[model samples]
Target chain A: MTSADQVPFDDRGLAYGDGVFETVLLRDGVPLLWPYHRARLLRGCRVLGLEPPDDAALAATWQAPASGLEVLKIILTRGSGGRGYALPESPAPRLLSRRTPFAPAASRWQGVDVCLCTLRLARQPALAGIKHLNRLENVLARQEWQRADIAEGLLADSDGNLVEATAMNVFWLADGVFRTPPLDACGVAGTLRAALLEQGVVGEAPLSVETLLDSELIEQLFVGNSVQGVWPVNTLTTPDGEPLRRFSPTSASPLQAAAHRLLGYVPLSGPSLSGEKR
Target chain B: MTSADQVPFDDRGLAYGDGVFETVLLRDGVPLLWPYHRARLLRGCRVLGLEPPDDAALAATWQAPASGLEVLKIILTRGSGGRGYALPESPAPRLLSRRTPFAPAASRWQGVDVCLCTLRLARQPALAGIKHLNRLENVLARQEWQRADIAEGLLADSDGNLVEATAMNVFWLADGVFRTPPLDACGVAGTLRAALLEQGVVGEAPLSVETLLDSELIEQLFVGNSVQGVWPVNTLTTPDGEPLRRFSPTSASPLQAAAHRLLGYVPLSGPSLSGEKR
Candidate 1:
């Protein structure tokens, strides 16, 4: 949208990352995960002491069909607070919704490779897991490696504990157990992770570099975020050492099969890297 | 200025705080600290990897005499970047200049009460000290204390060491030494702090809460930011302890005197219990 059609510069989002944002994928004009997205958005608003945006109005704007896959962005800014950090006694939040075209499949779904980034996530229990705007760390982490060939990076906390990728939550399968790092201290609690947890699909625990080195179980792996539903990890490496013994998902792994089924990916969509037909 | 007359939303400044900005106080249409502000603005651009704005063109717009104290703002966004944080392989930054009537200075400037906020400045050595747009900490800190009577809050790093006020650098006179926390590890290297340091009017040292209390040398105190210059501290208290002693400048303290001169205040602006002069 043009600047004229947008909110003022005083927008708290621009001023301070003083807001929460969500990017939902819209397929043929239908928002894929409305309830989950709205719940998180409202939860974020509560965290920042902001008024919730009108749900009906937001849903209406995204209801119109658009060709291919589109991204519906919801930016909730704490409107404007005079010139300081404190929330206004009464806050009138600014909620903005806009949609833009995005690559429908491979860029997000078809699975992308990732590198382990050197930047460590800071520990901020209060702000942890929320999609708040203070994202310089993510920006810096993403900038660490800029080759078009490498799609994204897996970042760890300062203590060498696995956090998540720059823009996605990570999952690793070892010994037939689906595991993801607990978000109790840091990292965002991804909607997909929450869904998987509720469905008893994956378990949360502290995953560390050494744990990966010691674990023998590996059937498949992937990272997930709200915008990018899930992308398989084709290869993983770090300067320290190669942690995984073999780095490809088993063609017949139940978890992978279940994930594909749940995400609506048919076998004809793509074959495994080993040229095995799914 | 209203949002309509200016730059676009895609401007990187709003997107990533991927820009440099300056807030110069204008009196009778003339910017009071133009040179310092300009220098810092340029320095900020350099750090953010953006070219300096065109100063000649910027000056042209400020030619008109404005009424009352005006706030002149200059934002140099990395013009625009496409969907990512990597500086455009090659970038041309956008420059936006605006002027707003000075928001009424809090009457409590002399001795405004302050809360010790919960937010802590993250240690990002690379981005620390520059007033780039990644200000979520400040936004969060300011949001913590909204009592109209409390001027601002003093913030600490995650380690509970003093950093600065929500929008300004802080100083305390302890044991007759004019001291402020070092900014190398975390905190903004404010323009005012730079000036004070360069003039050798204030001593730079690591200040801890323990040191602040034990020294007990405070006779007067204040916080400094570009927009409002130096504001005297009235009461400095955190939940951890009783109110700290206040310090006022005298013939012996060139630093406080210099600050007073710089801010155009007569010697020793008395402390205000609520930060208001009255």
Candidate 2:
């Protein structure tokens, strides 16, 4: 069925969030960093005990838009007909694809303000790192802010460790080393975050709000995901919009530039790369 | 739309588990403990920031089967259209209803075997008690066993405090008092459990697996939900199927009988009740 087709009412994804999804960046007619997305999707299927999608079906679904930058969301649910949370003996997994127009503002790449969310994520190690459909925690965190200027909200696990943004992975340059939170306990391991880690551009480290607000230690901060490359954190604020700290919106750091390159993001003006301009 | 109809592709419920649901037990043409279910559903809507379903619409959806006991599942989603987790400008919530035949064996009312799931639920107090759709933990916990004989799987929070069964709230008679685990940390506050608490038949208390296995302190164990009424726990086993403890199966205790009465469950042959026979 096409992406616009209605899903069965009894689908477990709608009932119990029994599904996983991937948001891929499609520039022009090509999907960026698809291998990583595919791997994560497979891992999610394995974790949820769902059968992997057929290669041909997945390829057909990933057909990118003819042109322009867009967001392609792929949702794979354990298809309908299971008794409550119980799995069906012979499962038919449904794959849905939808593409939406996306135009990231050029100014956002330079810097964006973020706020700390009051809703702390639960430490669910079993469901962590997989982009499953059970995203009520993120929904609640996103609801904490309503300002048009606030680009995202940062979340922490119940233990007070800084985890991730509502829709992105977080990274900071501290003591001349780039680091991000480890996702062993909670947080979605974004594809962009994985690429940075794989390229040895970012290291995993436990961070807290105290460490993040410490201007003396943290030199720079940024948030990123597969859909939107990386947006430098210009200022950090509390849920009440009280400014906690402000980082200068300087030129992209060497590590941030590296991350941008890995994500196939070419800055609008600064550096030259072989890709479509934003 | 009827339950057999398809849900729209963009439904937030399918996309992000942004919804809540209620399972009402319908005996003949009457819904048992509906007020409790309605209150919980509205509470869930408030917790998730969704518009509550219209009373008339809800009443129409809850039309019970003509005869016999059946499960009436009502799902209320935050409707379609949202930019990621951001709230829609004007929300249009969707309410869906479905019914399935339910036939709980009379023997189960006497006693049933249960097992401990290795999966520990993450403690998220913000989403605790309200039965929203983010239930991957329950799905994973249910996957811990495939044996049909194991009626339910008991779960504990990461802190080692017993929470609830995968699909039912748990209670035990300890020192001549009925107590259940508090849902402030995690676990769904079931409708039947609410009824028992409201009726002053059961109290909330922290419970541990060790305490449950203790034969001297714990006199009897039982599990209940809106759908299945109550079933006595005859045996508790480890994930590996090793017998942890066994309690003698006697006729329904006073608390059990009270819970049954509150749930409008009438035993097939035991005590007389002013309700349709199961």
Candidate 3:
């Protein structure tokens, strides 16, 4: 979309990160897991005390013709709140949908090499568990890795609880069960993770770094968001002495197997990076 | 400035709150407190690891010839950092400026009423002190007060220490001395606060809520920022059972006296609202 169709400069998203956003993958111009994305964004608006966008308008914004695997991003912000942080008397949320060039298929399937980030996410229950625009924490964490070899970085809360990857959620297969960190305290509630939990593909609770490292029964590890699907972890390490390990769902755990099967696709190495155009 | 001269849709500031901004008031088309605003923005960019913008280019963007009083805002973002949080290698920073109608003289001095916000600021040393756009805390705090009677709200850090108002840095005369909350923990390093400190007009330290209520020495309260020079607080109250009181800074406190003389302004009042154009 051109700049004219976008939100105004005074939009609250730019002023205070007072908004929620969703990234949905468009397959043949149809957004995958859109309902889940919508549900999450709506819930986030409730938490932030702003009205969710009109469903029909949102759907119209999503209608498009996709040439390949296109990435559609929806940003819903509490529209112009005057000059300060205060929400206006009549809040009108701004919604914008935009697309980017497709991603490499390999980065989604073959888990990308990741390092533990030095930056820590602060616990802000007021803003926790929402895909809000206040993402300096993620931005700081992702800045940890500059090398092309590293595709992502894992993040932890201030208390050292393994929270998530910079842009994705983290899940581990331990004792044949899928486990990921709970979002009741901090971190965004990833749409994919919620879907997995509803389908009994993963269990939610705080995952400590020590617990993950000490688990000899660990079989498979993967990180993903709704739009990116899942990527198996081949090795994980950091310059700060975090241990590295390889894992796979196909040969290791039934939970991982179930997750892959439920996603309605055969597992592959890395994301479909540079794959044939769909 | 016209809308065309403003930031575009893809601008990272509107996308991720991925920028820092400074708002200065222009009197007679000459922006006041330019040095203070410029310095704070510079420090914020350094904290966020962004390249410094060319001062000449930035000064040129301040060319809007709005008459009388206006608000000149400078937005500095880390250029277009793409979809992910990782900063693009060797990327130039985006620096844009705009002038808008502002400073209804009546709103500046007669002093504005404020509420004690229910929302609390989260502590993050990595992102604290500097105004880097991750201001959901301020947004939430501002939302706590909607009554036209209350023009602003005061925010406290998660630890219950008085931080600042939703938009301005706070100062109080306690025990015949001017005291303000330290920004080293969790508050924006406001340009006005920096200017005041440079002039030795205020001292910074942790000002707990308990201390505010317990200190009988408090004479008057004021909040200041780059845009609003100084607005005195007439009343301060909290729903959480904190005893509230009003003091006369003009009569008792030397610091307040000096501030009044230096700022050379009275604050906004109910009557002033009608005479001034917003």
Candidate 4:
């Protein structure tokens, strides 16, 4: 509950990033998409050969005397054991959860400017899709801009393959089909994207920047994550700040309509800015 | 300083590994090779766009009541603000320094065994050679073995280019010359390795496992870091506990001898096992 009680200098999570974390939106003391976060956390544990902890207990401990709207962040680490990278004999998982209260963030990606980050994401299939803590690539990419005008920066894999934004998964509509980049290479498969795919609203495809920018068949672009749902993307800019291309929903995109119509709780149109508040 | 007064859950270092750390071996209340760690820490800050903290003040605080044979660990994070990957405006660097009492480790790789990890390191030139906190690769590689017989695990890049052991830079004595893997792609450039290079004891060369095993021109193999100087590698094995090759110093390795004799304080021939203690 307090800073001193949460972490220590010997924490393997801080020492070697031997951990995974999930940020779930809390609606009246309940974490939305609890199942997905729990699954991902367990998968991360399996990858690092750590035992899974009871996250339900952790959520309860975090939401005691909870408020209306807050973010419940659950971090499961290899605990304060292990000499270097090798897991300690009989390793127990360390669970650190917190609640940061905030107003519900509104969707405001329509007509926003995004730049292609000069920095590329390294291809690490071992760490791909499971949200582990070794996130220097995302950190460095997000640091590429501090302007109030830029909404986000698109990142590409080492082979110039379009991956995702720094903090969100990307989706684009083309030929009346909804396509998103496959997370087989390197990108966190966010819960919103998974939900969209499972509900027959979005499909997976290998996306390249060239194909997205050059194809006239592309109709609309959007990005989203579990915490912040879908928001339509409009503009793409080069690293030089030159306008690369502009896109909009040419027609009433069935996918967008289905996304909002099917997932009623997901906000699609609202006024908000990008930063800590969002 | 104790866990009661150390890192918080909201610290970016724990949340994102958005920080850098230095593990300097303390000799009787003195941090050895202080300059290299300082330079690397500052350089890491630059790469992450974090302002350099006054490490001198941190050192003073750490050594105020220092004792014999310990490791002084310093962590500099883009302190507790910011949401997601973006750096907070006018960020202040948070400094966390701790004295971990440790007995000086000695090199015992004369007839030791090391495994070649199946997990390959991804090439990230931007983060290559910097001791950033994003170390999932090393953690995964190290988890390949738990047996006391295994000394360390060798890691190669995705392209099969030999990079380093889990925590040390490797030096190979082949063709009657000293050569080390080019760390322009992946692997941490440790201070001891850098010092050996600066002292004209090691040179850069791209090595592959095939070359090291097949070519009879190869002779001695050694690995090192600041805390543990030069360790002579003996046998190599595959990840599934299969023998790849058995090797020893074909003759007296000049590199190893110089690492000990030339550098007065480097404990080269001492009998200290590698693991969390080292």
By lDDT, who's the top model here? 2
Please list all clashing residue pairs in model 4, or write none if there are none.
none
lDDT ranking from best to worst?
Answer: 2, 4, 3, 1
True lDDT of residue B86, candidate 3: 70
Q: DockQ of every model listed? A: 0.43, 0.81, 0.58, 0.69
TM-score of chain A of 1: 0.85
TM-score, first chain, each model = 0.85, 0.92, 0.86, 0.87
Off by over 4 Å in 2: A1-4, A268-278, B1-4, B268-278
Give the candidate number with the greatest TM-score.
2
Kindly report which residue stretches of model 3 are placed more than 4 angstroms away from their true locations once superposed.
Answer: A1-4, A65-68, A101-104, A213-220, A239-264, A268-278, B1-4, B63-67, B89-92, B104-112, B217-219, B239-253, B260-278
**lDDT per residue as tens, model 2, B1-278:** 22334577788899999999888888886788889988989898888888887678888875634798888888888888888899888988888888778876556776789999999999999899999999999999989998888989999999999999999999988888999999999999998899899999999999887777774788788888878778888889976678899875545577677877876666434434213333
Q: Mind giving the per-residue lDDT tens digits that candidate 3 earns over A50-95?
A: 8877778788766766566677878888887565665677777777
lDDT (Cα, tens digit) per residue for candidate 4, span A169-264:
888887778899998879998877777788878899887778878988777787667776556677788755678888874223455555544333
lDDT (10s digit) by residue, model 1, range B1-278: 11223345555665666766677777788876577777777777666656776768668557687776777776666765656556676676766667888753545344455557767776666676777777776776766654555666787777778888888888876666677888765777776677777777787877665555455555656777756656566666653434654444332245556765665545553332332352
Error of 4 at A119 (Å): 0.9
Candidate 4 off by > 4 Å: A1-5, A61-67, A104-109, A250-253, A257-278, B1-5, B65-67, B105-109, B250-252, B261-278
Each candidate's fnat: 0.41, 0.83, 0.69, 0.78
Best by DockQ: 2
DockQ of 4: 0.69
